[model samples]
Target: MTNVKRKAIMVSLIRKMKEKGSWTGETHIQKCTYFLEEFLRVPLNFNFILYKHGPFSFDLRDELTALRADNFIEMEPRRPFGASFMPGKVAEVLETKYSNDIDKHKEQINFIVEKLANKSVKELERVATALYVKKNEDVSKDDMVGQIRELKPHISKELAKQAVEELNDYIKEAEHNHIIL
Candidate 1:
């Protein structure tokens, strides 16, 4: 798909996520977008890397800025916390334009939004990082824990281990549900 189409889909997905009343924060939006592109084959291609809160993308941030500029989404400032996202005037039109494609992947979208959107930012950091590690496939469990701890020194070793285990379970569930191939 064209970049324009992909972005329209992203904006539409963001709007749908907001309507669910579950994914309001910037972190939730980013991670949900990541899962849509990376896992559910939505083709947003945002160049994510393992940042402080797990996979982050400057490209995605830019797209969000564009969305704000285009009035497709509104950002509500939260002081020390990051801004929350709400649907803007253009959201409904974009959503309707992309509804069929979005509906085709509703199960994966819902799974991602419901499962990860409600987690605290810290917990999301752990989960997203663990999933990143799991994606490498060759990384041993011990190595995964070490990597997670090294990246997030504040996290306990036990917690890191648990996160990896939980991520493994999620992978299995996704595969079973055909959310991932």
Candidate 2:
């Protein structure tokens, strides 16, 4: 996709995330975009790695900075929780210009946002890390949980299991609907 199309998707994500009552922080955008690319295969072309919070893309981070610089998104301070992102003054114009491109992947975007928009940062960390491990490692379900716990010792075994289970459900649903290839 073109760079402008990618920006449109990002703008739409920020807007929908806010509308869905998400924190819309940098971490939220990072994890959601990770799922959009990895799970739904939207081809945003971000190279994600298991970072401090979860799957993080430095490229995407840079793009977000550019979006802010270009007045396509605004950072709003939320005090103790750090700053959150919001659609900027020119966001709607970009969205309008790339409406067709955005619509092509609308279902995938909405799927990710609906699944993750309301999750707490901690929850996102656990679940997204589970996905990272699942994608990057060859392991059975039980081993995946063990790996998740090992990767994030802060998370309990039960929570890791739950995250893996949730990830499995998402995969199954996506496959059923032909969202992922």
Candidate 3:
């Protein structure tokens, strides 16, 4: 996949983990990645999403299965979530919400350290992406909101709504793909 696509999926998955505070399974990662590419305009790695971070209370496999059964998510590889959802109006004024507002969003994501665990470092990287975007102006509110609404059918209305806000945070956090490390 193109670097742009890969980064897009990474941003979406990370936003999901932060918004929900956790996620599980290869499929959920796959599902999130698929929609992410469409909405965020990026591609993803399912294996990267599955790589374990640490022992955690939540079981990724079980959560993925349950979420799928509940119709809250889908696992399609290349398909975007269905069309029942639309990102609502952008908040009247954008403001910092999650993660302590670090002088830099990267600083905040790095703060995510090992207290809680998800399946991958990519997840951490994704959160970093949101932080990067929130702090930068590369992504507009309209673009971010459009991406969140794309998840409407597969993810819940409430979840999608929340995701929109989370996307804003994620976009705020996303760094330029070519920034020198």
Query: Pick by lDDT: which candidate is best?
Result: 2
In terms of TM-score, the best-performing candidate is 2
Better TM-score candidate (1, 2): 2
lDDT score of residue 44 within candidate 3? 29
Worst 10 residues of 1 by lDDT: 14-23
Sorted by lDDT (best first), the order is 2, 1, 3
Pairs that collide in candidate 1 are none
What tens digits encode model 2's per-residue C-alpha lDDT throughout 17-37?
A: 999999999999999999999
Ranking by TM-score: 2, 1, 3
lDDT by residue (tens digit), candidate 3, 1-181? 5433333223333444445444424433443433233234332232222122211213434544544454434443323432221111221111122122212234322323121134343443333233233333455555443443342223334543444465454444444332112
Error of 3 at 90 (Å): 47
Query: Per-residue alpha-carbon lDDT of model 1 for 11-84, expressed as tens digits?
Result: 76676677677547878887887777676666667888988688888888898898899898898877667788
TM per candidate? 0.89, 0.96, 0.25
TM-score of 3: 0.25
**Worst 10-residue lDDT window, candidate 3:** 85-94
Candidates 1 and 3, the one with greater lDDT: 1
User: Which of candidates 2 and 3 is the stronger one according to lDDT?
Assistant: 2
Cα lDDT listed for each candidate: 0.78, 0.91, 0.35
